[model samples]
Target: MNHHDPLLEQLNQLISEGRNPDTLHIDTASTLDIVTAINTEDHKVAPAVAACLPDIARAVDYIADALQNGGRLIYTGAGTSGRLGILDAVECRPTFSVPDTLVVGVIAGGKTAIEHAVEGAEDDHGQGALDLADIRLSAHDVVVGLSASGRTPYVTGALAYARQTGCKTIGVACSPNTPVLQAADVAICPLVGPEALTGSTRMKSGTAQKLVLNMLSTATMIKQGKTYQNLMVDVNATNHKLKARARRIVMQATDCDEATATDALQQADQQAKLAILLVLTGLDVESARTLLSQQNGYLRHALKAHC
Candidate 1:
């Protein structure tokens, strides 16, 4: 190892890298006991995230504003952090009926890094910015940088470049007062403390990142009218299972029978929100679609406006 590496010093100061006093005996503990110990630490994740709800909500506002203005939401990270971002981005399409280009994920080392560890990828800060540039990042986009340790060079670099481009930037990390947090317009650092295995951020840090990303994306989509009450009104019926779900959602939204929901779904081309509007308002497809369009796809708003 290079003794002069600055990251070494930086990592040494990170709370995510410190050993857990509570899990010291985890190595020799029974399997159940080991898992129990892990579970105990896992329980700490939610409250930590709860403490940062303000900043997380603020980040959501930035993302929602960007999306409303026709900009995209982009997440950049490395390792476990990167994979989590990709998971969230991919889910948005099926869950909210969004296009592929709307929510984007960029992992360090490009596509290969998503599956295999690309040596020195996260350390290449310049590549982080380059990756954003390659994606044609604009001021209208929101770039969210995810890093468990809160000091991943790649994430920090991406945040810096995003800021320079006048892009709305958000940093999600598990440690407090680190570069990842410092580089962005909004800092959402949920201090999940030390990992159970010490320096293995894939545990608590990964959990924290997932939780924060969940809120960041889910809340933003909700604000953008992807949901009607608690139902996924905008869900895309892209597959057999999703098609069934879309029908069920319409039924639940309008309290109609399966046949009625199915009929409306067919009329609305399997769009759950539109199907609900058709079922409840007894409107033709064209009128229901026009109302939804007038309300910017907000189902409840469209219903209220028509009523």
Candidate 2:
């Protein structure tokens, strides 16, 4: 065993890999005490995320501008980071009625890695570059690299490839000044400190990344006219719950009765934004839809035009 190995040194230097002094006595404490310690540490995650708001906002602007101009938002990572990226990407379709192609998630070991661990997948730096290349990455795309460790080869490689393609790159990690952050055009590092369980980035670091990813996708969608009056106007009502929600959104947006909302939604092909416009403006479905399209799908703008 080599004592001065660089990998060993790197791990030793990582704050995420360091033991938590707050939880040092957990082994001998009661279960309640142990959970309390974990809870205390979890409370620190939000403020850490809040500290990176400026950087996160900058990343959002880059992603939103690129997407508005016919670009995609690409998330690439390994392990837990990769899984979080995929979760955020898959959600955009149903949440905002956006095409899946508009937001893609590239995991280190491919789709198989999502449900099961793929050993050595994150260690291959070149594979990350290849995965983005396979997707036909374009200059208009914005690539976000997720790596809690801040030094994952897979994330760094993807960011490097994105930069090479002249795409805007955003790096998200929980550690400061690491390769993943440095490689990004817009770096968002939320220092959540060491985990309650030593070296388990799946905990605090993962939570921070999840928060940031949520902001990135949600804010970008809002900027893209996917919402109306704080409602998910473009929400894909594929099931009963969302269908009910869509009707409710129409009612809320137009202050119409439930029956009126249902009728407008039926006439407007279940599009909440269109339904709301029909109820508020008394325009026919086609006319309301034309108005929405003219306003770039912004319900507020469409409503103002009718006024």
Highest-scoring model, TM-score: 2
Query: What residue pairs are clashing in model 2?
Result: none
Which tens-of-lDDT digit does each residue in 23-114 have in candidate 1? Answer: 99899999999999999999999999999999988899999999999999999999999999999999999999899999999999888988
lDDT for residue 147 in candidate 1, whole number 0-100: 93
| Candidate 1 minimal-lDDT segment of 10 residues | 1-10
**TM-scores, all models, native as reference:** 0.97, 0.98
Report how far residue 239 has shifted in candidate 2, in Å: 1.2
User: Candidate 2: where is the Cα deviation over 4 Å?
Assistant: none
